[model samples]
Target: MEIRNPIPPFSLETALEKVQLAEDAWNSQDPIRVSLAYTIDTEWRNRSEFINGRENVVKFLSSKWQRELNYKLKKELWAFTGNRIAVRFEYEFHDIQGQWFRAYGNENWEFDDNGLMRRRFACINDLAIKEQERHIV
Candidate 1:
């Protein structure tokens, strides 16, 4: 059996669209919707650990929300190619104890012809401090 590409076309516009969709999904705080953006067998290297599959994606996201309070994220498209995109983003959230922190990260995403993410590698660094320490909103 042959698989068909679900995406309309590969262009800079489509790349931007995918980024916007991801941003909206994250903003909604819906783990399932976010997971759907990736392939069923997606591979991920988030910070240190390696995770695969949609089920693991959902679980990881759920755990993330459980630990990160008042989570809000913003992602920007940095660059793109035929089936790859680079994104830079920052997120601010508080811990279980209400100790606020900001995390900055960059991600390289590879998509299949159907535009579903096949691989994602992200590197993030977090700085935890008091709320008063924040300068950027």
Candidate 2:
């Protein structure tokens, strides 16, 4: 079944702006700032687990940083239609044992009328290897 987006075509530019704001928030690594992009009751499915609420989002992100040291992420806009957007990104981080990992993923987002994300779904695959194995510059 084809899912119809509630937002009109003209509003896609604003959606793109929101996507940029979220990207900036993630790059900052401040969970508080990133959490603002989502609604207080936002829902997310990251891989297999389900996450709900802004506070839980922040907690999950904080825990992620504790494990993924030196975490850096870069997101690229792939496609968008009104309040929905698709992004492709790569993130690099090292664990406590100093083993580095580069994860590649794509996320699909849905936002409310106020440009706050109401739902998000992400699919990620990781290659856990030494730092020297990376080829992308």
Candidate 3:
């Protein structure tokens, strides 16, 4: 649980590790586990909603995955500096009606010295697609 610390000044390998770690955590779709990677006082702007603190993060993600059934995600590191990292990501999921979609997004993350994300801003767009169009396996 205490992984990916020593916040920032990342090498390419560490940056990739960070991104993959995030991707894997999210794909698990466990809100509580994902919230642990963030600071207790984390601030987040997820799409149109404003979220503050780990409790809100857990609430938001639980609601998200509940609606985004069979969610799968992939993320790539776009850039990194001192304690900030930028990422681009894609995810596929379906609604309760069984309509599939793919979502594209970018996130800017700032980490605390302990490697917990202190701030996150994300912009995302969803595109409806057929099941055959899904690329994530």
Among the numbered candidates, top TM-score falls to: 3
Per-residue CA lDDT of model 1 for 1-137, tens digit only, reads: 22323353457787778788888788777889889888889999999989999899999999999898878888889988777889999888898888999999999998877778889999999989678776445
Q: For candidate 2, what's the RMSD? A: 5.4
Ranking by lDDT: 3, 1, 2
lDDT of 3 by residue, 1-137 (tens): 45445457777887788888899899999999899999988999999999999999999999999999999999999999888899999999999999999999999999987788999999999999999999997
For candidate 2, what is the lDDT?
0.78
User: Candidate 1: lDDT over CA atoms?
Assistant: 0.83
The residue pairs in collision within model 3 are none
Per-residue lDDT tens digits of candidate 2, residues 84-128? 788898888889999999999999998776667789999999898
Cα distance off (Å), candidate 2, residue 38 = 0.4
Query: Pairing residues by index, what is the TM-score of model 3?
Result: 0.95
Residue clash pairs of candidate 2: none
Off by over 4 Å in 3: 1-6
Q: Which 10-residue window in model 1 sums to the lowest lDDT?
A: 1-10
TM-score: the better of candidates 1 and 3: 3
Can you give the lDDT of residue 27 in candidate 1?
Answer: 74
